[model samples]
Target: MSRIILLIAKFSAFMLFVAQVESNCPSKCDCNPYSWDMNQIDLDCHRAQLDTIPRNVPLTTAKADFSLNKLGLDPGFQLKLDHLHDLRNLDLSANFLESTHIKDIPDSVEILDLSANSLSELSLDDLPTNIRELNLAKNGIDSINGCSGESSIQSSSQIAIRFDYNAIPILTRDTFGNCSASFGYIDLSSNNLHTVEHNAFRGVIQKANDSLVIDMSYNKLEIVPFEAFQDAIFDMRGFEYFSLDLRKNPLLCSCNMSWIPMMLDYFQKMGLKGVIMGTCYGPEESAGRHLEELTKAEFKSCTEYSWLKAEIKARTEQRIMPFWQVCLVVLACPGLVATVVLIVGVRMHVKDYRRYRDYVVRKKRQIATQRRRHHFRASGAVGDVLLNSSIKNSQK
Candidate 1:
């Protein structure tokens, strides 16, 4: 009878432990049997018609998978998860979230999967410093906030961020300026990005401290600004090994592409391997020819004149031209004025001399006329006197 009682006691203890584990799970959830070995409860409640997260989650749970659930919690409900201090991994993918549930997340949560949701905009100011892995794929996020100055993510030693298929239109300056991570990768594919500003990846490259990979493919980008990749290498000591995947972009094939040749040469000389995955979107003939397969003849055929290139060259030449052009203009201006003044003075002097000569000629003509008149008067007087004497002698 004693042996039978001991066996019953052992069975009862086991049942009690099982009941305790089951009770720790939410009322509508199921606990995996194998997950108990790690002393953590793994609850799977996917596709459940849950509107809000259940408060009865097991305290010892380290990971929770709630993917594909209809748990469309109100924006206010994100703050409620702060109570779950022990959660390390939380998967809320495919729920079609609209915006951030709350401004802050639990500090203890490390890995967060919010992929395939409807998040349009998010701010990282409220995130805890201990966060490591963050998956935000398929969201409508257009840009990264606080990517410069003091608030940039200078180091992701414990953080990995993924942003794929978000349809981002443009990447502004300092977009990822301070991101620092030993091992980091950014996926900016299948978006509407047409331009990447200078310093767009400053934080990420700086934080990488020598290890980083950036996947920027399947976008509408026509040009990658030189400054965007200026200091973005793994290290400045030498050509650091880094990966850049630029595929499916509409590369404009023109003389403006001189920059492309220069950039490729720079990367090759630095011992870096960068891949250009797609062909050029040139004029009609070579619209979709791959860049790698293109020969020099084909490239020359596709190349066209670029006004921007001409303008740049013109401006550069103007900047470097000697100051003598300006100095010559300045020096010639006074000479031109002096020549005009001398010509005017000579004309005035000639007019004055002509007037004086005319006055002297008129005076001489007047004197000669007066002298003839006087001579005629004197002759007439003598004739009158001779006539009077002759008349008197005739009368006598």
Candidate 2:
């Protein structure tokens, strides 16, 4: 019957797929086909000390784990693996890779782990077009703009890029420039971050679709980039999805950060998931205080420059000199500079005057010399006229 023939055909196809999976897998790797979809396979080759990628992987491999190995450190490391047309997941962590090593990952890769390596550059153009989950933790990343180039290539997929435990110094407004829509989940924890400029999250939050959870904990951040998250300066409304974690930072929650409490209160009322925690690092009395614990009346004297004043005060207090003494030096510095400038100006004027005086002396001496010569010439002309008169008298 027709139904019997169809069943036989299905059985034959299943057997052929099983044979392919059994014969094509590398000897060191454990390869198996999915129970539901027999054609798709998973290859686990981790901890195998693989210096070279095995060319014997199944053509239907959907996931491959080649982590914990000193794989070939070439930009074209995976170029010849085109047989894995359905390869989606790849883990190459702990391979000590740089940006060049991952420049040519397969376009089919959706999840990639290049963590625990030595990557420094943060360009996303090296990523696969379909990358959704990218892990770059424990690297030496010192720059950003990862989402700034060809960023629309991953627009179809939500992003979860991790840059934890790096040496990233600062975050500017253009850090995530041109990021795709619905892009979210950036981890910047445990970095050498010193500052986050205002509107720093504008690039990543411009096209936020649902939730934007940023982990900026464990840095030297003195203040949050509040404008990009709460203020009307960027029209950042709909606060149900914006979650910022600022714990463990040496935050200077002073007057300028008076706006921090207001932002927390607004986000809380507007469906905040959890508490947005920020602790103070200075101002003597507020050193161990939390931003939420501050009374509203405490900020009566707070201004836009209050945090700056606190920073300056804190910096000056740390020096060997007293605050007033440092202020004296700072205030008297300009006067010292002015005195030097004045002295230099007086010396220049004195030098110019002396040069002019010498020139005048030389001119006077030249004039005296010319007057003597003119008197002598006049005397000589008189003598010549007298001689001519005497000659005429003698001739007469």
Candidate 3:
């Protein structure tokens, strides 16, 4: 009898534990009925008849899968998610959310799957600092602006930003301005972007280090601003693995596309490895031909408006001026005058030598006259000596 009583007490304790876990569910929603674990509770409110999100979700929950629900992100639903501080991953995909829902995302959330929504203009400030991966594919976002807030992403990590299949008309200047220097990978493909604004990615390239990779493919971009990439290549003191995929754009092959050939030639000579695929669209005749398939004449026709070719020709001509053509007149006049002067100087020297010879003959005749006067003086002295000797002989 006592053993039966002990068994009943153990069964009551187990039932109380299970009831306590079930009572911890958020108000007005069904938690996991099978498992009493709070973190692992799959709160699947898919297609639920509830109009507003339950505010009292478990704080320990990691994943909130809220897909295929008719939950419109009106003002009431936006207020409910304000208190979900522990949510790491939230999937609100396939829901027809308006632009206001993008503005209401909590900063604590990391991974948000808002793909297949009706978002037209998504501000970068709507993304939280902790967010590492975002899915805004198939949306109506035309441009990407950096988050403008005092609080920045604290995590020292790379965020994989994916924006695919959106009809972006233009990439605005300083698009990723508020991105931290630590961000690394970005994927922007299948958009309708026509012109990339100057300094569109200046901030991102300045902040990102060597591990950065940007994928921009399948856009309708006709012109890439050379100034936009000049700073990224020269000013930013970082090794960038920038791969530009400019394929499938209907490039206007008129004089406007002169920059294309110049950029291609520069990259080819420098051995730069990147995608440069496009077909000419304008100028009447070569409307639908790829750049690679065009002949030399077709390429030259495109160079009619090329400022680079004209500048190159001007520089080359300036470097090789003909030496004889420039100095011929200066040399001819002076050379003839110098030859006449040299001939006159040689003739004058010969005449001066003959005059010097005649002057030496006159000087020799004057010296002979002086020598004859000295000889007469010596003979008078000798005759005086002989008369004195004869007077001495007579005295003896």
lDDT of each: 0.64, 0.72, 0.63
- Model 1 lDDT vs. the true structure? 0.64
In TM-score terms, candidate 3 sits at: 0.56
Q: Any runs in candidate 2 off by more than 4 Å, and if so which?
A: 1-15, 73-83, 148-150, 206-209, 228-236, 269-274, 305-396
Cα deviation in Å at residue 6, candidate 2? 7.6
Q: Which model scores highest in TM-score?
A: 2
RMSD (CA, Å), each prediction: 27.2, 21.4, 22.3
Tens digits of per-residue lDDT, candidate 1, 89-204, equal: 78888885665652445667778888888777756554444566788888887765742344423234535677788867888786665544333567787878888887777655
Across residues 189-298, which tens digit of lDDT does each residue of candidate 3 receive?
Answer: 79877777777766555442444556666777665655555455433333434455555766666555555555555444334433345676666686787655544344
Q: Which ten residues in a row have the lowest lDDT in candidate 1?
A: 147-156
Error of 3 at 392 (Å): 99
Cα error, candidate 3, residue 30 (Å):
7.9
- Which window of ten consecutive residues has the lowest lDDT sum in model 3? 233-242
Q: Clash pairs of candidate 3?
A: none
